[model samples]
Target: MSTSGGRPRRSRSTAVRRRPADRRQQILDAAARAFSEGGYHAVRLDQIADDAGISAAALYRHFPNKYALFCETTSGLAERLAVAIAGVESDQPDPRTELSELLATIATTAIDNRRTGGLYRWESQYLDRSDAEPVRSVVITQHRRMRTQLIRIRPELSRADADLITSAMTSVVASPATHRASLPIRDAQTLLRDVAAGLVDVELPVPRLEPPAPAGLAPSAKREIILAESISLFAARGFHDVTIEEIGAASGVPASGVYRHFSGKAAILEAAFWRASDRTTACITDALAVSSTPREAIVELVRRYVEVWCGNRDLIMVYASEIGHLEPDRRTALRRQQRINVEEWTTWVVRSRPELGAARARYLVHAALAAISDLVRLDRSSEPARIGPLAQRILLGA
Candidate 1:
């Protein structure tokens, strides 16, 4: 390069040159972090490019579009998790040692990737079925491996029991990725490993073998239909992707009729949040009223929570994932209600285990709740009968 004076000047290196493969990986890392922080719809490709220290054109050369990038980022993380599990040394003769080592490895990997590990949890739903299948397959394969080790350790556990326990352990390890709860790295790993290992020996409550009675017909009221359909649509496609017309069509009501029932999509979501909060509060009241001791109250609360969550999976799923799209005032109110719910759990947990300070108790409670919620989302066959007891054990840290 020549200077403006026409004399050849020393060429200045402004930017480091990177190989295409290296730059593509850099983009993936940045995209993972961006998607993890802001979710699928909220993050922009330009922001990811900037974070990767590349231009928008350069990013396009690597990834054709945002959705493609998102799919790769999510599936890539799942593949990484599978590979991490595959790398765990499993030659130990004692299955117990093998299981412990596996859990520890999982905890370490989850903690190490905590910043981006949560992408597959809530955001991967945005992927098309074809793109999502690879991620799902990877996760299932890892779960099967864990379940194998679990079955080896406990030869008598039914396959269903082992699957549930294995799911709970993976959820426990992955729980740290969902929240900002902090501990020293070593302490965090130990805490996760211990909680996961505890689930191996947990005696799951016997599942009900009887078939449930046939469901009754849907509600005839237009307002009831709108709310129910809206929750289902929101849970399945996300709030932003669902339109007022779609909700009306799903409910068999005209758009004009839907307006008479609720103000808009946001209003329906607000109503869903309120509905969940009211039901949860009622459960807490009922639990405390029926229990004479803190431990009893805790167990009752866990059972009630599992019941509520199971009965209203669509509503609860919307409640968990769509909260960010609500208006600030309503979001603030709902978040306050959520904290109150957590405080209720924390109080009972500390009362039952006095040695666990409020902070530690709260952390454990979050992990337990995350485990149940994640399991519910991931496992369609999850039964309240099995979940209630497993959740109770996790909450009590037994």
Candidate 2:
């Protein structure tokens, strides 16, 4: 029988044909899925080849190298994002209407590409600066356009205020990338749009955390630089993907000199983990000291948490993403440290909101932390300081 479109149905035994372009697209789609789930360092070329139903040598014929393939895939994804945002219904004169439309459109795109698209949050670091530039440009363009629209809609907003609000709005739609929370696409889109609206509708205060002074505890300046540079490299390239030579070059040390500060790469990683964990504990302690009540303490905790994270986004992201790659013993210790940090917040939240059982209070604390984590790969707007208070309010449910 012919279908409604008047095309006759093919026999069940008939074989479908794919054009060269279709084959190429199939490879890209397969590669994107493989890369996103396994990460750049963890995913092998043979794995991608298998996923594409091709031999490893055949895969090389399609793309020169893994780096080239990754760049192309990410650049294409960014282009899709640009197209989606630009297509948002813009005929409405009200800036708020446009904002809402934009957020919905972004949410739909994110949900549709959730399987492969969200992988960029973890994998984009593998792309070199030269390869990443085009993707960066496209994202910058979208952010600029969105921020301008936000300022027009709310004329009272300073450029910085507009940026903070825009980042928060973007964070809401981008939240899906950081977690595996599943919902119907329509429900997810609606939920994100409402959250974005709330973030945009509020006024955010400037962040108050002063820049941290260089710690006196480092063994030497060279060691500090090595640790600092290693964190940046690890954050950008994934722990397993980065080499000691690369870290040395970045840190202005020879490969042999790296051994002087730390016995091995894992040692550097362990030190970095402890450093981040210590900083987090210190921030929580200092914040609690200044707040008079449990409720205020929770608020301070949220604000300071955001402040600490924003300042150390690269170190923190790398630490969280690569902690699993560490030796089992070290990984377990760091995880316990992470639990302590969580408990600190959970306890304060329970004390402040007595009606919430420990279980529910812990959930809220995680939800708030999840919101802050959304800012990881997102570019900052002109007023990044406003994100601190906005995140704090989100944490406190204010």
Report each candidate's C-alpha RMSD, comma-separated, in the order given.
3.7, 7.2
Clashes (backbone N, CA, C under 3 Å), per candidate, total: 0, 0
Compared with the true structure, what per-residue lDDT tens digits does model 2 show for residues 1-398? 67789998877677475436666677788777766655566566787888888888888888988877777778878888889987876556887778788888877877777767655565346677777778888777767767877887778887766776776677667666544544667866776676566676676665456764554554459898899888888877678877889889988889899988898888998898899789888988998899998878877777677677777778867764565456667867876877778788878878877776665555445545666766643543222355556665544554
List the pairs of residues colliding in candidate 2.
Answer: none
- Output the TM-score of candidate 1: 0.85
Cα-based lDDT for every prediction: 0.82, 0.71
Among these predictions, the greatest TM-score belongs to 1
In angstroms, the error of model 1 at 40 is: 2.8
Cα RMSD, model 2:
7.2
Which portions of model 2 miss their true places by more than 4 Å?
A: 1-26, 37-42, 51-54, 122-134, 206-229, 232-263, 274-298, 310-314, 317-385, 396-398
lDDT at residue 164 of model 1 (Cα atoms)? 88
